[model samples]
Target: MSAEQAESEPQADLPGPPPGPAPPSSAPPSSAPPSPMQRAVQNYLRHVTVERGLSTNTVAAYRRDLALYTLWLAGEGIDDPSGVTGNHVGAFVQHLGTREVEPLKASSIARVLSSVRGWHRFLLEEGQTETDVAHETKPPKLGSRLPKAISIEQVEALLDATRGDEVQQLRDCALLELLYATGARVSEAVNLNVDDVIDQEVVRLLGKGGKQRIVPVGSFARAALDAYLVRARPQLSLRGTATPALFLGLRGQRVSRQNAWLIIRAAAARAGLDIEVSPHTLRHSFATHLLAGGADVRVVQELLGHSSVATTQIYTLVTADTLRDMYTSAHPRAR
Candidate 1:
């Protein structure tokens, strides 16, 4: 089936575990014949989007990985998906993991292999192929690296750094506070509406794949947002528009994600934190602080709008690190 048909099919009306995986796809280039790999990948992507209801970004990632796989398969003269064996897939993964062409990180390799496996599963589900050849495949065991998080004191310092005689400074404070308070992704925070931020107690986040989540606002964040909503947002939006954007740029439209990230970086620089700061740093700090105060992981996962509890479990590593540091400082065993 074509990619469009696979995607637009009425799979919702049928009952079964969701479609496994499909081949990756590529955007059709004008005035060129598509190679067999491109055709198969496009078919795969269509299945993913239509049947799986996946986000376009995810589909895009799969497309890139599958493209690389197909290129390697072409080099090996293996054009047929039906003939692509588990050894071939595994070899492809190994080559991707170790190729000197570019220094591919483990995470990148994992992503590529994952796309291949997804495609394998897709074929099996469609009964176009036999068993899932990738069934025994495994992603590289990634070291459990904790997400970067800062302390409450540093956060206070960062917010205080935004204190100045300028409206932009006030806006930055509000943005910083909202990020740390709501544990929101940068895009969600920037796209927020005045209506979306509830009674100053909660903010509605439109997360990945357009999922809506309600997250509680911390005390400090509520106050910061109140001040921004009362003072700075109006000034920023005063030009000629009656925009509903909770945050605005110099143009008074909704702020861009890059600008939001830049705002956090600038604020961190001014505060002399000297650490890599992004909008997610605030989120990491939010989750870590909550967990340190005994917040439930599942509850945090719900608030963060994570589809899986396993994704949220990474923050626990940060909490564990905090405990270890405390133990090293206070425990009186002879060195």
Candidate 2:
């Protein structure tokens, strides 16, 4: 039987343990089979996870967004991918806006719509549907916001704050230095192996969609890594089972993205900086500083492992604003 037909068929009841308290009458049975639309969503999720090689967080986001979409489709009595239409997709967008608790922002709504569009496109390409109904459903426009970057002095202070001979402190210092030096996403940095950096001048980073790129290590960061590996990592490694991770938590396993964020925040607090700092803040500062120092945008893009130079060009806006502020303050003008 076809997968959908098999799913629709009622299963043979077998003897089981006595039931507990009855569920509310309004609730559907827990064993209810998934609709055909839901099955398609599962297929698409697997495709992205396995074939597309998207990161865990990215795959989770796609799953969440698509789950909501399928639930909405079921409410509308649309149980098949072929049954969806542009009007249905548009109505779903409207339904999202009408949500009462913690309404989504325009950017968030746009992201949901983007997910929906990708799903429909996938369905069409897979021959599961005749048309991509969501093709014309436009996402809400988002206003441009420049990336936030701290001054060079602020960055130096933050890095300095992580300095100490303690095991965790050595790891933190090296972590922050590598972050500012390489512009790696926190996930990429935390996911690193010891061999990825040890005895190498260039660090290999595995970015989104399993794309790999090499970024050169600066002298300061290299020195920090050498110290951490020599004095700190050996001690940390003995705390738990053996692992090849470059950075380790107190448990001796790989440091997590959350832990890395905490490291950055604690350092920022110690540095007495009033601004919020996260791992991405260092990445932004890295790009901004490079552009401000007259580095070529294309070169920065390569270093950043950005798939397109357009993504790197955003830093130029930050640099331009900085130059404008400097010009207004330094140059004699008839104002």
| Model 1 misplaced regions, further than 4 Å | 1-36, 238-244
Estimated TM-score for each candidate: 0.80, 0.88
lDDT of 1 by residue, 1-335 (tens): 42123323455666656687854658654887776557767888998898777766788888888888888988999877777888988888788768897857788888888898899888888776788888788888787677999899998888897876466767878888888888898878888899998798988998887789999888888888888888888888885388889987765667777777777777777789978978888889988998999999999999888999999999998899889988888889823
Highest-lDDT candidate: 2
> Model 2's lDDT to the true fold?
0.89
Candidate 2 per-residue lDDT over residues 1-335, each given as its tens digit = 32123223457899886789855689655998887887899999989998898888998998889888888888998899999999999988888877887668888898899889999999999999999999999887789989889999999999999899998889999999999999999999999999898465889999988889899999999999999999999999998899999999877878888788887888888899999999999999999999999999999998888989999999999999999988888889914
Any idea how many clashes model 1 has? 6
**Against the hidden true structure, what lDDT does model 1 obtain?**
0.82
TM-score for model 2? 0.88
Error of 2 at 23 (Å): 18
Task: List the candidate 2 regions with Cα displacement exceeding 4 Å.
Answer: 1-33, 198-200
The stretch of ten residues in a row with the least summed lDDT in candidate 1 is 1-10
Cand. 1 TM to true fold:
0.80
